[model samples]
Target: MGSSLFSIGLTGLNAAQAGLVTTSHNISNAGTAGYSRQSTVQSTNPGLFTGAGFFGEGTKVDTIKRAYNGFLTNQVLSAETKLNEYDTYSTEISQIDNMLADPAVGLTPAVASFFEGVQEVAANPSSVPARQSMISTAQSLVARFQNLSQRLNDVRAGVESQIKDTVTSIGTYAKEIAELNHKIAVAQQAGSAQPANDLLDTRDQLIKELNQLTRVSTTTATDGSMSVFIGTGQPLVVGTNATTLAAQSSRSDPSRNDVNIITQSGAAITIPENLLGGGKLGGLLAMRSSSLDTAQNQLGLIAVGMSTTFNAQHLLGQDLNGNPGTNFFTPPTVGVQRFSDASTASPQVDFADVSKLSGDDYKLTFTNTTGGYSLTRISDGASVTAANIGLSITPAATSTVGDSFMILPTRNAAANIGVSISDTRMVAAAAPIASAATSGNLGTASISAPVVSSTTDLASFGTAAAPLKLTYSSGNISGFPATLPVTYTPLSGSPITLAAPVASVPYSSGMSIAVGGVSFTLSGAMQDQDSFTLGPNAGGVSDSRNAVQLGNLQTTKTLLSANGSPSATFQSVYSQTVSAVGNKAREVKVNRDAQESLVNQATQAQQSVAGVNLDEEAANLIRYQQAYQAAGKVMNIASKLFDQVLALGQ
Candidate 1:
């Protein structure tokens, strides 16, 4: 009986010791990375002989197993991937916005300066210094355009480089995943309780990283190996082999390189999974074409419009020494057509000087909805019609070679007709040449002398009939009727004589005219409409003249109409640019919010199944302790029984 009692007590002591050891093991690995707490499952051993009725042997440990949920672990990895991708894309777009919107460091100031110079020249038409200043400002504008374009190109290059790095990282992670798959499969086959759990953790981590680079989905095979595929169901990994990713320039444009992932055996695969909901690389690609390229092209288009329009006008008008044709701005090439280039050329058309030639000498050619124009010039009481501008290149004997001339093309509101007149020079009357008319001239010449009579001549220098009548059909001058003639005229209004000669100089370079019943201001301020408008009494008038005058050369906003109403040509481009910017910003905000919500849901799901629980571990510890105690009780009972038998023998 003492032996039996001692055996029972020893069983308790052994059981207590085993239970303590199990608890310690669990505690030790609690802080270990990727270590799942282990549990000892106990079961009773079978009885040796049970023919009649026999009690079972003490409990034994069935297996030490890890507690894990595959679905929960996968959910965590997937969430992490999406979070990284969204975060990456958001950061890239913010950078793009910063680059574009930067004020002092960007193109805005340069554009402003160019227009300001134009305004200054317009306000001071006769100032040579002002004209020169305008030219310098124009050059600066072109330089800024080139600089901005280069910076954008650099951003594109950086994105390509980043894509290459990302692809390399994807390949590295892919290889690691393949290796871990092999390890896990091997562990399963070997019947190990761990089942390469740590390897699996590492694989999960790698896959999360891969997802951030691009979108991916996975399938578990029967053998426990994983098949990874990106968007469009292209396999990235199958069994032990991993597909590699590469970068190559686009087929049509070698300057742009795109990422491609394929199998080790060279099967093409659809990569750039992140592009659909891509990360940083994807964001850049999206913006590269949409915002960056489009904006640059739009800016170029603006420059093209300005240069082409100005050059067309410059080509038609005679330069200050009456040179028939000199290009105002050099014909533009594919891209470089800045207005500043037009402002700084030699013998440049002075936007400020409206006094150089006859009052009616200025001719503006307008290609309206109608095809042809018959225009008139109002200068020195002399009127030249569409039929008179093509007179002989040289003036008659009564006319000097260096006489100033005027060609006026007016669009009459009442007549609904266009008339252009070119007439030879007469000395300015009392008022300024721009506002002077027939009453201002002191000469004997009259308006009808050049166009109606062939015998009239400028007897003295200021004589009115000495000037020739030039006429143009449409915008083109067809002929000049040389009815009046005069030798060189002087300050005394005396014609050149064999005894007393006179000095004559070429006509001034700049002139202005009133079209459509309103005078269009040509001040430097007229170049840019950033802070100006042509509304009724706002800047000038409610007519089409003010609209065209206030029209922005740099911006695509139709300030005026060709037929004198509101213009639609310029407003369209402006509206389109504004819409594009707003849309991109909205898209970024929406995607960012959606991604955050998805991450939250995924995180909660992962936590529900995979998260650690201290209370559950405690419960498991107690259960394992009781089983160990039962096992020890049987062993102790056997030992005491043997001891008692030996005592009996003694």
Candidate 2:
């Protein structure tokens, strides 16, 4: 009986102490991250064995368990990760939207202003001031284009930098996780449950962060280690070791803006992980590649289109003050020659100095019955044959500047025979001056600025404003001496001729001017064959006068304009930007609201399951106290029994 009573007292004492410790532990870790309250589970000790069977004696601690649900924890983690990604994406989109849509610096207003300037020039074509305004406006417009392009480029560059940073971060996380795997595995092997719970918490936190940088998948090994992998089973971590990730420049051109990820083993991994819907890096990359690049390319295309098309029109039209010259605009070309003569074993055409010439300036003329020739320019380094030109030419020993090759009437006139300047950077050949300059040549000129409010001027210039006039010189030049090298100097308004054996020569309009075997017709007045138009085509690199091509802006796309201007070619780009912003804004608002509701619900559920009840704790304290007192009484009774036995033995 004494033994039974003593065991019961010991059991009670142990139970009370365990309960108190559990309560204290819970209270101590109440604010700890990811900590769950622990409960002391009590169970009756194995019953004392009697003659036939065992009977329950007293209570003892069964197990201490944390109050937590894995499913709920996982739900919270997943939702939080998605919420973080969306928040980052929305924020970045908003910044980009502000950049594109800010009215003070937007492309639309600049485009509108440019077209308006063009209209102003058209209203008063002869006005010097109007023309100057057109030039100024064009300069401003090009400046804006450059500015927009540079800004987009900056954004792209920033994204590239961020990608590098993310790669480094990914590497760091991978290494840390692998190290933790080593530690955890070592602890597990030591025959203890091992403080693995803390390790798991840390690993989970790292995994969440990793998911934000890129897509990742994880697998558990039998040895309590984790293996993390990326796209296509590219292992990031295996057991205690991790592979490193690096950013490398593009293979095709290192200088260009591109990057790729290489594994520790030097294998390039195709990681569009940056495009996955997980992290800030992915969103930033998408923003740069999908939208920013497209916008820039669109702008470049616009510039190219304008340069090519406008030059074509300007080439065909005769400029005022009629100067016989090559077309003002020259587009880029592959320097290749077309052999017009099919029958002739050898036919030669030469333009050693094609610096001042363009393919558009060339015109074919047939003089002999043996005509049928093709002209083709080589592309890249490809050879061109007479067949390629789609026309054949008869034998001729030598081709001169004036000689021409006739196109077969049956052949398609459009087939490659006349490819308009596909590239805007082509250089053209320069022609010789016509009227020689000598002493006593008449050439004084003055240009008047357009009057702003003269009815007569307005009527003349098509603008409700005063008209302006630019003067030119036209007269006989025979009185002056000739055959001497004469330098031509351009005056403020026009070029003055000096030395001249004034050759009075009148030919039908549209007579082709052949320079270095390339021919173009002159539709305006000229002092013999020497007059040339001041065109958009600038001199080539070798020539000092190669100003036009070098001075103009080079672009590949158009910009959207405000006010619905016809010249606004990139309206779609702006429209898409606006749409993206609106969509992101809507999505953010909706998601944020939804998240708030989810948080509230989660909080309520957690409170129900894990919230501490002070009253319950107080009741537990009283119950433990009573149990302790009862155990004390049992001890006291045992002591009394022991004392009585001792007295009897004595």
Q: Which lDDT tens digits does candidate 1 get at residues 1-650?
A: 44544444454544455555655665766565455544445555564465676544434455555556777666655565555555665555555455545676455676678667656544553455654665676666666656655665676677677767877777787888888888888887787543555566567657766777766788877667788876456667888888887776643234556667665588544444334445444555566555555555444443443444444333332222322223334343321111211221111122121111111233212222222222334223334433243211211223222223222211111111111111111100001101111233332221110110111221221222232222212222111212322232333344332222212121111211121121221111111111111111111111122112212344543322234432433224434444565567667667778877887887667644544456765776686577557656665777777788889988
**Model 2: residue 280 alpha-carbon error in angstroms:** 2.8
Candidate 2, which segments miss by more than 4 Å at Cα?
1-4, 40-44, 57-64, 191-195, 215-217, 229-234, 252-264, 301-573, 580-648
* Candidate 2, 369-458: lDDT as tens digits: 454333433112233444322223344643443344322221111111122322222222111111112233233211111111111111
The list of candidate 1 runs beyond 4 A from truth reads 1-54, 57-74, 192-194, 262-281, 287-291, 299-590, 614-634, 645-650
Model 2 global lDDT (CA atoms, 0 to 1): 0.48
Q: What is the lDDT of candidate 1?
A: 0.45
Q: Model 1, poorest ten-residue lDDT window? A: 424-433
Query: lDDT per prediction?
Result: 0.45, 0.48
Every model's TM-score? 0.58, 0.57
